[model samples]
Target: MTAYLPMDREERREMLASVGVDLDHLFDSIQESQKLKKTDFSGLQQEGISELEVVERLTALADLNKRTDDYDSYLGAGFYDHYQPAAVNHLISRTEFLTAYTPYQAEISQGTLQAIFEWQSYISRLSGMDVSNASLYDGASAAAEAALMACREKRLYKVFVSAGMHPEYIETIETYCHAAGVEVEVGALNEAGKTAEFPTEKGYAAYMVQSPNFYGVVEDLPLLVEKAHATGALAGASCDLISLALLQRPGDLGVDIVTGEAQALGIPMSFGGPGVGYMAVTQKLLRKMPGRIAGETVDRDGKTSYVLTIQAREQHIRRERATSNICTAQALMATSATIWLALMGSSGIRDVAEQSAAKALYLQEKLLATGLFENTYDSPVFREFALTAKGSLDLYKLNQDLLAEKIFGGLVVDDNRWLLAVTEKKSKQAMDKFVETVVRLAQAQ
Candidate 1:
């Protein structure tokens, strides 16, 4: 007796018949005995809780939890809240954009292909790389997949990853390569927050590192890339796309592959994902890249047309030799990014990046001004940094107090330090509020 959309026995039977299947086929992929075993549990039915009752119950539960209006978020190890233009969302959410799938049919999907082509061009220019794919699942997958591309050659038994690379991404790569039986080596960070180790003696496939890495410190690219290349290993960089507006481009830094999250551009941080990952590589490495790629050409009418180019990805070629198992791309999100960049243009994007950098510095200065916190790393960063507070205050408790002030504090880096993220969304007033709240909490302690 399910309260929601309960189907009568006859209706259920008709549903199964309409699908041209029986109950067994519905559970065909799973072991049949495991299909809602009758003896496993008790089924209880209350005569459907009233809508009002449900709302009141939820409200009561919420009331037990504290509410805060002063939320100043410092929780950006990766995703930051950047101001998205209204037009970006409005254009990307149209039914045609939202509901579309991969444009495998060139004749019917010119518009979608054009949008992807624009996205590719924008990403290529931004990364200072040659070609760009339509999009990947997210940054972590793109990083791991890029590693595979870099390390897939014979005689390359090992890959080196930077310690500053986001831990989750490292885990993802390890998981993917472990199944493939490839060994992974981790490079330790130097005191200046850059990758310092190089496996020059041992032959390897690639070195994977992140710029403005997990600790929010920028790593030395040219020297690190040179080191990897000196060992005959490909250099792959994972970076925050927004930061690229002001930082040295990956191509200029001699990176062979660049992959990173595009969520910061205009996509809202939907709590870890539903965002797009962008992967760009030098023309030399394009054949090894994964995901769908759009290319420009002329149609039969001699008018401009766009089609899925570099047909070596999972969706376009033989399953075994395909560069990836990914069949679906983040079509709508890529469109969002295209719209975002088109609206912002080059100068606007740079302005946003500059403002974010300035805001982060302002917050750092204010936090240091309190004389109650210290920087954990000494390096140039884009928008986030670590702040170590005096005394062993419980970060969870401090967070609770800050929430009461409606301020979201930074991530808890450790027992004594917290990682705070400042973006263009944060203003001087917001920084002041956070600083004041932290100072008050410190004084009380």
Candidate 2:
């Protein structure tokens, strides 16, 4: 037990004894190094802290983060620095919206269910898929769950993932596959930062790719999807959701499943997450999608009504038939996304996508002109791109210096490479200043 908690040692021992397990047995599945000890935090003072002290402590810790309020961020691997409209926050905080967690009571949860239905509608239209679920945990889990859905559909144990996909997402897929006794094969990417052609062999349940993939280089979605279909495998994409505003819809490109992180849709990075994941599928695969789906209908009196419709998760069906164990939706974040989308109508979203892409190109050009960075691939980027550091460029020191100036430099990918992202919020002046700083720092190094 944690020292901070109010439980006494004897009570804890008694509780465990009643359950027929010791402390060690309770934590046996966890790695020994990760198991927390009594001394981990030094515990709170016996008298406890006042509200003011707690606020002071939290504020102090928050100040330690070298983030916005004084910084320009250029980091994006999965999450981004897209502008979050004030309206999104203002609307989602209303008592009628904020307090509702689940739509268990159809009659009482009309507002919550309606928000979810709109979310699903927006996602379905964005991906050009037949339908969408309410929500998933995050991009990684969404991709992993899509892979499982594909495997179940094809009744095949093997799946292939593009190396261009985010490394962490690939790791998540592997973890899920391992548990289900499925085989995962990682396909290589060509010099262009797109997944290479599938091996000259065929048996795969699915082939998953990420557009504007981890390298920030866009993939050839149509070609990849065709290749997957040629092998009788379902084609899926873990997309960069904002890019969908301008890029071809995955469904139109024959992508059978579309899964992605919606953090850019008005949600803050919040130091990497609490991301909301979305999954959209073709009509044929709708039954196998995990999580709940909100639907619109008419009440007996001919009044509009909203309710949870298709629920194929472990919570709704027999354990053996359930598509996934996920029981609840990330309703709050999903509602935020819906609000974001509603505020940023189609043209608004398109403008953001276009400006982000243009800014990315402008920054990439400016960086190359500094002669301290070189393009890593010939492929076009959306809002993020990778560049290799030139000679004598101290990437770490450069970032540290930038940090002192209240600016987050590019994400360090490796010793010789770094990835930079540009959002609609990053103006041309910021890009120019970033380039000038890089040049001066590299010259000094």
Query: How accurate locally, in lDDT, is each candidate?
Result: 0.82, 0.87
Q: Report the error of model 2 at residue 318, Å.
A: 4.2
Write candidate 1's Cα lDDT for 1-445 as tens digits: 2246878878888989998878657668988776676654446653679889989989998767432222457778778787788898888777678778778788999889899899999999999999989899888988888877776643476899999998888999999888767788888888777787777775788888999899889888897788988888888899898889999999888899999988888787765678888899988877777878899999779999999987633444565456667666788988998899998999999998999898988888888887777778878988888877776666777887877777767777657778888787777886787788888976776
- Pick the TM-score winner: 1
| TM-score per model over all chains | 0.90, 0.89
| Tens-digit lDDT track of model 2 for 1-445 | 2235667788888889998979658778899788776674657576778989999999999888867547888989898888888988899888778777677889888988999999999999999999999999999999999999999999998999999899999999999999999999998889888887775567899999999899888898888788888889999998887899999998888899999999989798888988899999999998888888988999999999998876622455556566788777788899999989998999999999999999999998888887877899889899999999887687899998888777888888877788888899988787888888777767777
Ten-residue stretch with the least lDDT total in model 1? 63-72
Candidate 1: list runs displaced more than 4 Å: 1-12, 15-20, 39-70, 153-155, 312-320
Range of the 10 consecutive residues with the lowest summed lDDT in candidate 2: 312-321
Q: What is the lDDT of residue 423 in candidate 1?
A: 81
